[model samples]
Target: MALTLALAVNELGTNSVKYGALSNDVGTVEITWSLRPGAEGRGRELVWTWVERGGPPVSPPSRRGFGRFLIERVLAADFEGTVKLEYASAGLVCALVAPAPEDRAS
Candidate 1:
């Protein structure tokens, strides 16, 4: 899980450095995660979010890039999770929902 998360973060950070919040000195990225109940209050899941702020205005990419592909498709497949990428005018927002590891379960 640590390696998985590291890879995801690396990808995200690279993108940010190139075009997102990190492109500027004043911009920032916020990352947060929590354990939450799964469907019907069954197993637990992890809700991870990455929100960029104080950056130049955002706009959706014209086409999918490999980095985006890995983040959306590869990461989702790896964790059996869902990854959402939102290009808001304020910044980019990425939300990832996945089954929490067994050790993290209640």
Candidate 2:
């Protein structure tokens, strides 16, 4: 789980540096985490989004890259959550939903 989150952050950070909305220090990337209630506590999903003020609107990479592919594999294998990407006018939002470890054990 640590490794998965680390990679997620790394990928988001890299994208922010590359084609992110905060390109040139004009925008900022916002990241956050929270646990959802119900759903058998499988709501411990993670949301790592890159938000900025200036960018040519972005979309998820069509062909998965090595890093992204790895992230997807980890999320599905460990959390059983779906990794999703949304393009926003402000920037891009990436979300992953997974069942918590405890829930998976049962």
lDDT of 1 by residue, 7-69 (tens): 889988998889989999999999999998897766898899999998889999999988889
Highest lDDT: give the candidate number.
1
Candidate 2 regions with alpha-carbon error over 4 angstroms? 40-54
**Most TM-score-accurate candidate:** 1
Q: Which pairs of residues collide in candidate 1? A: none
* Clashing residue pairs found in predicted model 2: 81-97
In candidate 1, position 95 carries an lDDT of 91
TM-score, model 2 to reference: 0.73
Task: Give Cα distance to truth, residue 16, candidate 2, Å.
Answer: 1.3
Could you tell me every candidate's TM-score relative to the true structure? 0.89, 0.73
The segments of candidate 1 whose C-alpha lies over 4 angstroms from its true place after superposition are 103-106
Cα lDDT computed for each candidate against the true fold: 0.87, 0.65
